[model samples]
Target: MANTSVQTEPGTRRPGVLQAVLLLAGSCMPVLGSVLLTPILPQLSAEFGGAPGGEILVPMVVAIPALMIALFAPFAGQIVDRLGRKKLLIIAMFAYTLVGIAPAFLDTLPAILATRVGVGITEAAIMTVCTTLIVDYWHEPERRAKYLGLQTIVTTLAATAFIAIGGAAGAAGWRTPFWIYLAAAIIAVPMIFLLWEPNKADPTDSHARAPKVPIPWRRIAMPLIVGLFGGFTFYVLVIEASYLLVDAGVAPTDTPTIGGIAALASLATAAGGFTFTRIAKVGVNRILPVAFALQAVGMLIIWFVGGVPGVAVGAIVGGAGSGLLLPSMLTWAVGSTRFEERGRVTGLWTAAFFFGQFLTPIIMGAITAAVGSLPVAVGVVGIACAVAAILLGFGLRKSNMAPAEEVTATV
Candidate 1:
């Protein structure tokens, strides 16, 4: 609010490391929101067992944020476009910290789940603004790819850390992990000084008034639609991996051990995320096929091999694929739109991505009910992801919709 315009001409000068680090830091909040509560879900259920439908309702607290993001991200995007990125981000970050910590003192499962909705609302704005700012700050496609890849890497690593932290905190008590949400406030303070609205208008200049271009509905819609499936593919294993391990014979009480296995998969994800810039050279069309193939082979391995070793190996392979998939879909989604509509497109992409995540459990549950096994359901999803990737890759290349040059060029 002090002065939105920090630069006379945007995308001319390189952003400092501090800015990139700050954006990357903010990007972790949504990822943190998604995974931090996971390690504590069992404790939450036990504590609230007296409540009706506590089993389902307690897990909803784990899942409600994704639903909220899916429902409200587009609106948050609109706000970002109209009100300005930095302002919404600052406000959302503060709100996220407040709402995120509220559950620490809540008495009822319903009350806690309601607070989770607040967490999701703030996360919607935070994710949309943070991603838009990254694109706004970096002009070159290669640099954007690098930062987004790094974003994935940081997110994956942060998730691994948070899972361990959540487990450790949960060991102390169910509510202790909620304290970590205060990390958002720590992030917001630096952001107040370091983060700025990119490409702000100069009110003194009449020529600064720019003509609006109609949003390319098809171009923007394609990646988002594809991202829905990408999100589904990425989350299937993350959501079901523990169940897969248990179904294979691991003890249900072994949460810490399961978390350790997940941390290893997170390493694999970080490996793939770290290579995103190099992979971007191949174009998303080519990358998509390879990513899904890894997932397909890995899922098939789990289905046929059976047991903890299989689950662990399959997860690492699948995690690598998911890591690549996120950045590829993101790059594809935002590549077509320029400054004017990137926020909205990014918001829609966030909505699509999280919506896919939100749908994963329900879809997998239906598949499990029909098939009578969670592993088979997971394998079915893997096969579907593989088929889609291959078919889409062929069409994307043949149609030349995003030719190599077009994919690499900054909008």
Candidate 2:
């Protein structure tokens, strides 16, 4: 059931357009920082003198920041709720900008890894706070949906652009792309000037604040489960794409081209998200199952189809499904929570999302190592999604939560 006390104004009634843009920019920086590093892993490994399990190190570098984000998201939320979103966002962006540039100067693998962890921590702060602020600004379900889609679109587009840029820079020198983070500081400067504090007064300002209601774990459990599955699917698609292409006989030189093809599939996700507002009239409940089904089918296609085109098709299908599912799930999850607890609930949601992302590489790598082939490994992920879809189907059927329309109507 949706929490009745969290006053949800119509999302169309949001306060500031500039603030929204700035928040979106802040949210997208970490994504850009992460994806831009994808093509540079081999170069970094070679430069460092191959350590044990060095081949996995690059992935670890990419995934670990997400792992830390998952681990610390709750704390990040508390800090935001207590300290205010704008202040925390500024701190995080500054940290992100600095840490992003650290690798250019640091030569050791450990030093780079340490900096990545710092970057992840800052990312958690920015992502959690930004999400809370989005909820604060946009109250109408449909409009909120559109903004969320826009957020996904911007991050996807930025990541795609940065991947190409990173690869080019990596070809020149491995450390060059880290300098890209400097742009985040530049992007955040205007955001800091424009973004307003949330209307909800900071609770820390007064000791006489009313006693808080306990968060309802039972209400949020189903959405959290869905988020976890979504994250897992996302990571599986991202981590396995390159290997899936390589196994199908594509040369290493062709990996970036293939990866770009897969990454381009994210555009479908953006489109799907945009399409979701229209689809909601038919019912999000009806749409969600179909979305998960598409994801399952996409994963199945990747498992069965091996070449570059196959990978591209699979990515498009799965990415579209992911694009659809994420906004729907987030809307459901946030709608279910009280306003006072939105930050914490969002934190948990972020944690679940990153946890699934964090687990994908390790699990898929283990499966690939054990089975000795990419197809078998991807097949395992397919099976996992199939199982998750079945569970989601059951959850949807049993769920008694308010319809999104009702939620919007109240707003």
Choose the strongest candidate by TM-score.
1
Candidate 2 C-alpha lDDT tens digits along 15-98? 455666777878787677567776665555456647777677767777888888889988987876667778888888888989
lDDT, residue 64, candidate 2? 84
TM-score, model 1 to reference: 0.91
TM-score of each: 0.91, 0.88
- Encode model 1's per-residue lDDT on 1-411: one tens digit a residue: 122334445443346778888899999999889877776665665688669977456667767788899889999888877778888999999999999999889888878888999999999999999998888776566567778888899999998898778767777788888999999999999899887665546332222245555556788777888888887778777767766777788665566776778778877887888766566777888887778888887787788777999899999999898888888888888864667677888999999999888888778878889999878888888789789878877877875555465345321
Model 1, position 370: C-alpha lDDT score: 98
| Candidate 1: clashing pairs of residues | none
Candidate 2, position 54, lDDT: 67
Question: Deviation in angstroms for 141 in model 2?
Answer: 2.9
True-vs-predicted CA distance for residue 97, candidate 2, Å: 0.8
Measured by lDDT, the strongest candidate is 1
User: Which lDDT values do the candidates have, in the order given?
Assistant: 0.79, 0.72
Q: How many residue pairs clash in each candidate?
A: 0, 4
